[model samples]
Target: MMTSKIIEYANNLIKLTDEEAEQLSNAFKEVNIKKRQFIVQPNFTAKNRYYVLKGTLMAYVVTDEGHNHTITFAIDDWWITDYNSYIFQQPATMFIVALEDTIVLQIDHEKEHDLKKSNHKFETFFRIMAERGLASHQRRIISNLTQSAEERYENYASKYPQIVQRVPQYALASYLGMTTEFLSRIRNKRVAKKS
Candidate 1:
C-alpha cells in the first residue's frame, strides 16, 4: 500500500485517486544522483521530468565567454528541468546538475504524456507547475534588475535557509550576480559584525 503522506502531497497539487496513485507509482522511476552529476546536459533534448526528493540542484547556462552562469537552484521537494527543451523537444541550452547527493523521482516524456492523457487532473497539475515556473523566472529577472548583490544574498539566505550552508559560496555568488570575492567580503563583514 502507498503511504498517505505521499498521496496527500500529490493531492495538494493535483487530485489523484487511489488507482491513479498506483499507476503513478508504477510509471515513475527513482534515481540516486551523486553530487556534480548532470541531470540534463546541453545540446540534448531533456526527455524526463524530475521531482527532487532530497538535496539541491543547480541549473546553469554557459555563456560565450565560457562562464557557466547559475540560472536557478532547486532544493528538496522542488522540480528541476530545462523547461523549454523538455516541453518543446528542443535542444537544451541549460545544464541541470546536482549540487549535492540527491534523490529524485523521474518520469520520461512518453510516460508523462500517457499519464496526462490518462487523467485530466494530471494535465491541470502540470499546467499549474508551468505557471509556477514562469512566475519564479519572472521574479528572478526582477530581483537581478532591481536588487543589489547584498540584498539578493539576504533574500536568498532568508528564503532558502537550508541551502545557505549546503551550497558552496561560488555557486551562491553566481546566483546572486556577484563575484566570489564580493561574496567573501560580505560574509567576512557579517562575521565581524556578529563577533
Candidate 2:
C-alpha cells in the first residue's frame, strides 16, 4: 500500500517501469510518527528524507532568544527534511516535528544515492523534485521580501486554505513572520470585512 503511494507519486512525475517501481519501493522504509514527535533534531544527522503519507509536520529552528521560527511545513503528499543535513550527512541545525500522528516513506542517504546512480529515471525524478523545491523556496523568499504582512497572509490563506485550517495558529503565525496576536488581529479584520 505504501509502495503504491510512493510509486504513484513517482508516476505522476515520470513513468516508471515495473522493475524501476520495485526498486524505488525497495529503497524506502515506512515510519510512523506520533504527534509532537521529533523526526529530525539538532546535533543529529538527518539520515532520511521523508514523504508525508498521512499527516502534518513542521520544520523549524529555535533561536537563541528561545523563539521557534518555522522554516516550512509538510502535509499529506508533501516532503520535509533538513536538506543541508540530509544531503551532506552533517549535524542538523533544525527540528522536524510531526504536528499530527503521521506516516511517511523515508529514503536514507545511501539508498537514495545508490538509486540515483543506478537509474537515470530515478535520477531525473529526484532532480525534478529538487528543482521544484528550490523554485518554491525562491518564490516564498521573493514573496516575503516584496509583500506586506497583511498581503502575505491574504495570499497564503487564499492559496493554502487547507493549511490555514489545519495548522495551529501560533505555528502558522510564526511561519508568516508575525506574532499570534497580530495574526489574530489580521484574521479578525478579514472576517469583519467579509461580514
Candidate 3:
C-alpha cells in the first residue's frame, strides 16, 4: 500500500520486520480531501497525524487581524499535525487545510502510542521524526530572526522548489512573513535580473 512506503522508510531506519510493517499499515485509515477544504480548524481538537499519500496540505494560524502565518507544509510522503494539540490533548490553535486534492493515511493518538509500545522500531522512528521536526522548526525561527525577507524567500524557494511552484504567491508571502506586494516585487526583481 502507499502508506507502506512511508512505514518502510522508517522501518529501514529502525530495522522493523515485515510483520511490523503490516501491523503499522493496518492501523492507519485512508481518506481523501478536496482542495481548499479544512482538515482541522482552530479551537477544535486534532485527533490524528495525517500522512500525505498525494497532494499538499498546510498548517497555519490566523490572527484577529486576519493574517495567516503558515507553520508548515506537507507534500507527498510527508506528515501533518498540530503536535501541541495532539501531545497535550488540547484544542488546536492551528488550521490544517488541503492545498490540492489530497490523499492521507491517519493514525489516531491511541494507535500511535500503541504502535510504539508494540514495536521498538516504531518508537525509534517517532523519536527520529520528532528530532527532525524540532531541527526544521529551529531553522525557521533562526531564519526569521537573522535573514532578510528576500533572503528567506530565496532559501525557501531553493529548499522547496516544488512547493514554491505549487503554492500561491500570497501564501508563500505569508509563510515568509511578508506581504504579497513585497513578494511580488521580489519576484519581479528576480525576473529582471534573469532578463
Maximum-lDDT candidate: 2
Cα deviation of 81, candidate 2, in Å: 0.5
Best of the two (1, 2) by TM-score: 2
What candidate 1 gets wrong by more than 4 Å, as runs, is 1-6
Q: TM-score each candidate.
A: 0.92, 0.98, 0.96
Residues 1-195, candidate 2: write the lDDT tens digits. Answer: 786899999999999999999999999999999999999999999999999999999999999999999999999999999999999999999999999999999999999999999989999999999999999999889988999989989999999998899899999999998999999999999999999
Alpha-carbon lDDT of model 2:
0.95
lDDT of 3 at 114: 96
RMSD, candidate 3, Å: 1.2
CA lDDT scores, all candidates in order: 0.84, 0.95, 0.88
State the lDDT of candidate 3 residue by residue for 1-195, as single tens digits.
Answer: 676776766765677677887888888998999999998888888999888899999999999999789888999888899999998879999999999999999889999999999877788888998998899999999999999999999999989999999877888899899999999999999989999
Q: Model 1: how far is 156 from its true place, Å?
A: 1.2
Best by the TM-score measure:
2
Error of 2 at 1 (Å): 0.9
Q: What is candidate 1's lDDT per residue for 12-47, written digit by digit as tens?
A: 888787898787777778889999999899899999
Report clash pairs, candidate 3.
Answer: none
* Model 1 lDDT, full chain set: 0.84
Best-to-worst order by lDDT is: 2, 3, 1
Rank candidates, TM-score, best first.
2, 3, 1
